[model samples]
Target: MVRCYKCGRKMKYIRGLKFNQYAVDGWKCGDCGEVYYDADQAQRILLLNKLKKQKFRLKLNQVRSNLILRIPKEVGEAMGLRNGSEIEFSLKDDDKIIIST
Candidate 1:
């Protein structure tokens, strides 16, 4: 059981709590509306915050008839992307392409 720091009340365990658009398990205080996350989930959110602040410039390489876009090492590590990892690609408007894992 977690206790709220501000109101000195028992916090309720909430599953799938949305934190910065990510689903995380945490405790919430009903009185003060305070939310708290465990260390592991907090670390994950911090990493995602760092990833959002970074920008990368990449080039496309052509092998045979396919073009390969290489992901930077730092970005790959932050996203936990591996060699065989599967990703989804989507086009926005007409000029921007979004890649999600």
Candidate 2:
């Protein structure tokens, strides 16, 4: 049971995206609309923010029947992604795209 610092209301437990990647348990105050994460979740959010701030330029290559988007070595290593790791692609809008593992 957590309390909202701003509105002094009881916080409700909710599951939300931790870093736009993983799901995490957090608290949200109904009255003030404030959100709070636990220690581990907060750390994950910080790491994710840092990762998101990093910029990587990649090139696309032509495969036999399809186009392949090359993932940089540094980015793959930092994200702990392997060569055969499974990933998901999402198109948010006309131009924006998101990829996750």
Candidate 3:
């Protein structure tokens, strides 16, 4: 059991606590309503927050009979994507697509 640093009250473990729409396990202080995450959870949340700050506008071009999408240099470098790198594409929803390497 974890104790709250502020109120010195026993903290309760909360599963699937929402942080920026991401679910993370956290400890909540009942007395002060303070939430805390473990090291792994905190790192994951930080990475997710960093990714949320990156936004790019790209243009779609038409080839002979196919559509071509160009990735910006910064985006590619950040993602560690290289020329001829294999990536997977999937439909996340009706309007969103997920690309993973």
Candidate 4:
């Protein structure tokens, strides 16, 4: 709910525009052509964030049907004590969450 820099009016929400990594900070005014928070540090940080987000879908390939997990032995020992014990699992949010049975 920030105001536009040029017009001093509330900014309108217009998504889908991508940043140039060094050319964006805060947001732009649709009514006026002014960019919000026009500072070099802010713009560079926004660009770094944009780069991190862009890296999300940039992976080309992944392994199929194989999952791997590495766990500490002390946690397993405290939970129950077995090599082949049964376990239950469910997803919370987007990760494969585990529950001990």
Candidate 5:
């Protein structure tokens, strides 16, 4: 069963494809419009997901098990995070985050 990469919904398998560089499959998400460029990536992710569903996965659910952040006190003050205020944590790309706290 094919699932949308972004939306966790069952997707209709339109076709298997071999693009200029990779093997892929076309799937349309009912809730979102994110098209996967490489189906191999999706399949790999789905395998892990299936393992989790089966209660057989035992992996850290993070990019890093122990992440570290060291910002100067002045910098934290400048960002108005010195008073225990909440801050937003946003993804910088696909692999990093910018926590403004």
Candidate 6:
């Protein structure tokens, strides 16, 4: 639990698209509107930001009835992606594909 340092009010939990790349969990102060992150959440966001800066070249392949996009071992490990893990993909207006875990 987090407390508002300025006004002594309880903080509320919230998540959203922040920093133009990832959605993070944080606390918002009810009385003073201050925002803060817990220790684990802060660490996760930092690693995610670093992973977002990495680029990988992959060859698309067909397997059975699906198209497979393979991620590099280092890149996947850095992003905490494992076999059979689920991911989200989005196509931006500029035709760039965004992948997130």
**Most TM-score-accurate candidate:** 1
Per-residue lDDT, model 5, residue 25, is 66
Candidate 4 per-residue lDDT, tens place, 1-101, comes to 87886699776544433455343345667778666554554555554454445422222343586564534454444445487777776776775464556
Q: Estimate each model's TM-score.
A: 0.62, 0.49, 0.52, 0.31, 0.27, 0.50
Clashing pairs in 1: none
Q: Who is ahead in lDDT, 3 or 5?
A: 3
Number of clashing residue pairs, candidate 3: 0
Residue-wise C-alpha lDDT for candidate 1, range 1-101, written one tens digit per residue: 89999999999999888877888889999999999977688677878799788787889999999999999887787678999999999999788999999
Off by over 4 Å in 6: 17-21, 54-74, 86-101
In the range 22-96, model 2's lDDT, one tens digit per residue, is 677889898888988776776655666676788877788988989899887656765668978989999999998
Could you list the CA RMSD of all candidates, in the order they appear? 3.3, 6.8, 6.5, 14.7, 17.4, 5.4
Better of 2 and 6 by lDDT: 2
> In model 5, how large is the Cα lDDT of residue 98?
66
Q: What are the clashing pairs of model 2?
A: none
Candidate order (TM-score): 1, 3, 6, 2, 4, 5
Q: What lDDT would candidate 1 get against the real structure? A: 0.88
Winner on TM-score (1 vs 2) = 1
Error of 6 at 26 (Å): 1.7
Candidate 3 regions exceeding 4 Å error are: 52-88, 91-97
lDDT of 4: 0.55
Q: Give Cα distance to truth, residue 61, candidate 1, Å.
A: 1.9
Each candidate: how many clashes? Answer: 0, 0, 0, 0, 0, 0
TM-score of 2: 0.49
Model 6 lDDT per residue over 1-101, tens place: 77888888889988762533566677888778788765565676676677668766789999999989988876776567888899999998796898878
Assess each prediction's global lDDT (C-alpha) against the native: 0.88, 0.79, 0.82, 0.55, 0.56, 0.76
- Report the Cα lDDT for residue 26, model 6: 77
RMSD of 6: 5.4
The TM-score that candidate 5 achieves is 0.27
